[model samples]
Target chain A: MASTHLKRTSLYDVHRAAGARMVEFGGWEMPVQYAGIVEEHHAVRTAAGLFDVSHMGEVEVFGPGALESVQRLITNDAARLIPGQGLYSPVCLPSGGIIDDLTVFRLTGDRFLFVVNASRTERDFQWIAEHTRAATARDRSADLALLALQGPKAQSILERLTRADLTRLASFHFTDGLEVAGLRCLVARTGYTGEDGFEIACAWDAAPALWSALVEAGRPHGLAPAGLGARDTLRLEAGYMLYGNDIDETATPLEAPLGWTVKFDKVAFIGREALLAQKARGVARKLVGFEMQGRAVPRHGYALQAEGRRIGQVTSGTFGPWIRKSIGMGYVERAYAPPGTPLQVEIRGRLEDARVVKLPFYRRS
Target chain B: MYPKDLRYSSEHEWARAEGGRVRVGITRFAADRLTDVVFVELPAVGAKVTYMQPFGVVESVKAVSDLYSPVSGTVVEVNAALADTPEVVNSDPYGKGWMIVVQPDDLRELEQLMPVEKYLGLIGEPAT
Candidate 1:
């Protein structure tokens, strides 16, 4: 495919003020980090880190049949969602493969908002609108400003600023109109870090106020303002999936380790029949995490080999900032998903030894 | 920008002769590029380092980069304080954040390094 240009977020000036090193990601000029990736990674692992992810897409699906339409368009059973709950689902293609991984937030009985990845924003919207026979979909990308406050220390930092009892919030649940940092936000206890954190969604103009508030509250708690670099490593460490690299339209959610989100019980949804057939036959390949025996870092699209024969390609690879060892995840034959399978990843013409292991390179107490 | 008293290496390392040994650290330009240094792996004390060889890895929030040794020497000391807190690279990279101390294998090797003005010239920055 052609390389697309990036987009800049509202926090660009704020990042500049904080001395963040900017880099282009999915057409957005975003801070890769202010201090460093590993340091920011360590901070979030030990405490908390702030992330400006406003570049991601937010589409509002409103009308009488909004929830029903979103459910029909995507693979997940969104109709089961009570108001104010969020569910992670994939917009599926006809082949039972994923279009994009998305977060479906049931804001009201007839209104739902979906957050999609930055790079797949256009495609996700097009697919949702085209497939939904019942709902009216509108892209709200220009209106939303998003921040992810993530880590073990996140709850305490948020609790200090918000009037809501965030402790009562469960995973995948959001409470709208919560006051944080003197502004109202649609706060969700969902984060890519796999830690106890919240994704703060607010209006564009209030970005500066929200960013400053987070910084002030985060300072006493060791909350580092992280860039896209630390964000990638942390999400990878958590075994969370990233689109384009991890899975795309050609890779089914079942094959890409997202079978949990595919509700085959949903009658006649997009890709439901194909997914059911695939489920009956079992997936040929599975996504698995691998630990490098050598110091060489594995990068995306690197070749994975077993017994010196290429079996699969690494979809995402990087040094585990906390582990200090090279780690990556990739797809391999289903038989090779078990722990202790020996493999090699080709990095810059050198074959590095890698062994299969369970997902999640780190887990905090 | 280069300090007039400092000698620069193309590998982005800098040295300021302090007594007999040289204090080596990354230049401000290098630190600025690295940004938000999260982890610093300093060379072990007493290790013989070769010119242009990888000495340590400086990990930022986005990527990990090798810190190259600008000159041949035996590492006599390292900044251990960085292990617990690496952001010192961003805070005080020039002084407290010095990466290592080394006894030069050849004192004449220092002559090959660019003087601050020459480094500024090479980087297209007007010499101060």
Candidate 2:
């Protein structure tokens, strides 16, 4: 896509000044790398890394029926979440096909926030608006900028700038009205990368100052300003799924390795019935992780073969720098989903040996 | 900037002809654009390579691009070091990053390749 018309985040100047390589990502001109992908990836794995995730969209649902509306719209049981808690879930079509995978944060008993993918912001907003009964949904994307401080030292780096007791904040929980770098922001103890981190959402105009402060505070901790490239590799290593690359509108939670996110026991959700039926009959296809047995790097759209026949296609693949090996995820027939099953990835017209491993090729200790 | 002594291919490869044997590697331009070469798959040492044909593959963190042979030849020697240190292709594209040494099928094909000035123009890089 032409980057000329792409939107720039509030930290555009900062990224440019740092010599970040900018690319068109989901309608936004975002940094894909700063120093380099591998360097930034290692930094996050070993120390800390800061990221501008302002491209992500946030929609706030407010009213007496907010909880009910969220429960009906998302596959996860939002009602189970008390105030200050968040949960990852897939918003699905009536057919059980995934509309978007998102995180829902319960700010209060009658207020909630849905953090949706940047590419699906408009669609998600429209879908939620249409499905909302008495609740009101407002798109807060443009007004807010999100930053992720991730890695082993993320807590230490953030704690230096904030008075909030980050040690008490558990995973998947958020605190609002927190003063980060002297700027009021919502701090969520969550991240796409498997590392311990906090995602801070602050006013758009205040993002530059907040980012500068975090970078300054994190310097002693070996923090680097990472970009989308490292973000992809880090999340993949952590076994987190990318919405467009891993799961899309055509796949359902059951088949996309996200069955855990589908709360079948919930009262009723958009795709609950279809998912329940699929559970009863068993899903025909399943997403599985695999590792290349050879040096060849598996890539997205590469054909997955078994017994000399094309059985599936790689949904997402990359050389896991942290793992020091090539790993990927793909959907194949249920019978071939077993770990250790022999497979081959057709890369550049050559079939390279691989085997089905387990999901989450890498996990934090 | 590209080395003036090397001949350039439109596909961003460079060749240093020494008699009938030519050393080949991707240019500095290609390396910068690729930004951190993570993996490289080279043709077998004895394999036949055709001009402008894909003889190998190079992968960066975000992309996989084919490495086109700058000249048809027999791959007499491959840079085995790249298997463990692919970033050399980025760090020293014209030196330690040399991918393969080839015995060209025809010396006349060298005349068809572009000189440093023309190659720089093709990529819109100011000639140094």
Candidate 3:
């Protein structure tokens, strides 16, 4: 693999120095693990874990047309969001194909910030910019760094460093220009992990200092430095969709079963017509979670079968560390989408028994 | 931590000669790379294995890798313990983690494998 073209995050040296195993992810040379995937995964579930999510892209849109652009670009109702609130939504093409999944934060009446997937950063920025003539969309991915402190102990650990009243910061709300560890940051009470956590955004060059501060403060709380490997497992257990894997341009939001995210009651948005038509016709296939009956691990691209006939394909699969089961998600025929439906996953040419289960293999207590 | 008494293959399998039979298991370096092995699939007793060929598979939470046989022979014994707790391969890769014991066609084939020092060099471990 020619990794010469891979990008590096601001905390690259810190991860390397800590003996993290680096791998190419979404065009960035990111750490796959620091200690171990399972160990880091449990830490996030039990205690707390810090993550370098700086590889995710950030786009800033501001002007009179900011709300208009956001409402037109995403499937969700951005108008419902007050300033300092964020909502997760899927950016879709006019044909209803998913362009990217991202979170849009309304900074002000006219300014919005979008946190997008790393690989789709450029594409999402171009698409969002082209749709907006009254507003200006600028990609600020290179100028910012994002860190996630997640788990049961996240709030306490973060409180030790920042004076912000975390108890008052509701979910999906952010506090801007907050001083954490003697540095300015934008802290959001949001995270990909299904736990109470914060995603802190800071200047790119200041990331190392923030990381070190969090690591030092988190030591007493049993916090571990997590990587992309643990992040994938964590999100998988949470039943979150990964853009390139669980969703893509080939799969529409309806097929992804992310219908709850689509707001048809709101004004017209991209893919509104196609999605409305599909919603009326009902989706043919729906993404469902399944658990393996045998010890075999179901992997991505594996065939999902029922009665010796192919029903669908596995989009994302993993040995969920916290759940202690082989859990995966796949798009199956709507008839087989029930929680108790029996299914078979083909692994290395051998059919393994599995059962369709409810989404989210694990939840934080 | 390459053991001096064990011979290693380029695939990172360690072999120990015990009379006419050779014990096989992955090295610590390989286990560290795999990390938190969740499941292991091993061949049954009396199964035929070829030298440098995949005998079974080792799966971690994040990855799945093949376990190559270090010697060609009939598998006289297999590690049944790993069927329930495959993480032994990560915790004790060289001792209790031994995968299979094969009665090799010729014990001289063991010499074809690299010595501990050479294997460590191949893995880019600085002399220590």
Candidate 4:
């Protein structure tokens, strides 16, 4: 085999033994799919799928002003969340542009864990540490491993192996020290997939054991080892925003169609004033969902047009499994933002027919 | 792995003569690596395709790849089943996962492609 520069996951050898086609994703050599992308995608959609998402960054943000400091860093109201409750937030720059979108779980009064995207993990931690240098938030990036158990049947499969009372654990809430096949771990009711799932954060050493156990426990339930391929498709179908692709440093919370995460009620934060100003003036380009008229799927950076002139660009596009059609989201003029508005996506420099539709092309039944 | 009856290309596509036209699909090794066959862009009937050039696209969940034609010809048929059932490629890649059919411009060009043993050799598999 040719020498590849991509770093391997903890489960790299396991994936290699499974004949997985590994690809460089966010600097980690992750299995793009174990069996095939569509099968693994449908596995999670219909049955259960396990993913080794150890590349995601998990940092500890605990101090006397942990809630207050976390609240200041993110666009969302993390101070309002109860202990064990998880809330999605976008960490922003001074200009109200996003650094990364993450989920913060208030593990305790003084301790919280912030789960961030894999690609922006290092820079995000650096930015957070630099902001909170005096505040005492510890950046514990090296000590954690993330595992996602997703699909329709994920809960039942997990319930069998872990003693964690998953039924009472509502979406976005979690408890630490749950025993998974005899290993203590922090399991969160948060996932990138729109389907009901859990993101288990475990000790680095316990990853392989817990992974093996989860796979064994999930076997009877039709759970398969899924890769990055299924993960992106599932998230895209759910209308979830990816940090670098969908929104980034040049994209603000207000312009990215994620205004709900920002709370102006708080006195001040990094991007509060900028978000507030945008709120009052109204955003020019809005993130909206649309369906392409043809089979050609629109990809990231593809231009969005109205009538004939280019207006914006597609941030993400795919053949949504649940919807069984080409659906996408893009930043377009607010004039073309409302559902049912006609638009076009310029794919490969040729205009293809499209229509602005409501967000969320798929909702679990 | 490429079967003895099939002709293979360096691009990982396989073509087999079916009813006087060539039936084509990606190899099992290609499908195994690409992992989920989520969506496939099938070529239109009557469209001309050339050797070593792309005729369509195949997308997994995370990446999109081009589908190449090993033989030059006009497309006579395409697998419409993949329009709504792309996973069939993963499940039955050598059988029902066939992508398109084309009447070869040169029948001798089929021999110019990799033979079954050579195809297996190219993919690093033991020839049957």
Q: Give per-model TM-scores.
A: 0.83, 0.97, 0.98, 0.91
- Residue range A82-115, candidate 1, lDDT tens digits: 9989999888888887888989999999889999
DockQ of each: 0.23, 0.69, 0.82, 0.45
Q: Which digits, one per residue and each the tens of the lDDT, describe model 2 over residues A6-106?
A: 99999999999999989998999999999889899999999999999999999999997999899999988998899999999999999998899999999
Query: Which numbered prediction scores highest in DockQ against the true structure?
Result: 3
For B67-88, candidate 2 gives per-residue lDDT tens digits of 9988998999999999998989
Candidate 1 global lDDT: 0.85
Q: Write the per-residue lDDT of candidate 3 for residues B1-128, one digit (tens) a residue.
A: 78899999999999999888899999999999888888888998989999899999988887889999888989999998887778889999999899999999888888989999899899999756
| Whole-model lDDT values for every prediction | 0.85, 0.92, 0.93, 0.84
How high is the lDDT of residue A314 in model 3? 97
Query: Using TM-score as the measure, which candidate wins?
Result: 3
Give the top-scoring candidate (lDDT).
Answer: 3
- Model 2 chain B weakest lDDT span, ten residues long: B29-38
- Winner by DockQ between candidate 4 and candidate 3: 3
Residue B31 lDDT in candidate 2:
88
RMSD of each: 4.6, 1.5, 1.1, 2.7
The residue-by-residue lDDT of candidate 4 on B1-128, one tens digit each, is: 45778988888899898767898999998887665567788779999999889898897655578999989999988999998788888778889899999998986778878887887888788867
Give model 3's docking category: high
Candidate 3 structure quality by residue, lDDT tens digits, A1-365: 57999999999999999999999999999999999999999999999999999999999999988899999999999999999999999999998999999999999999999999999999999998999879999999999999999999999999999988899999999988999999899999999989899999999999999999999999999999999999999999999999999999878898996888999999999999999998899989999999999677888899999988999999999888888888899999999999999999999888999999988888777
- Model 4, A270-339: lDDT tens per residue? 8998888888999898999998776667889888999779889899988776667788999998888999
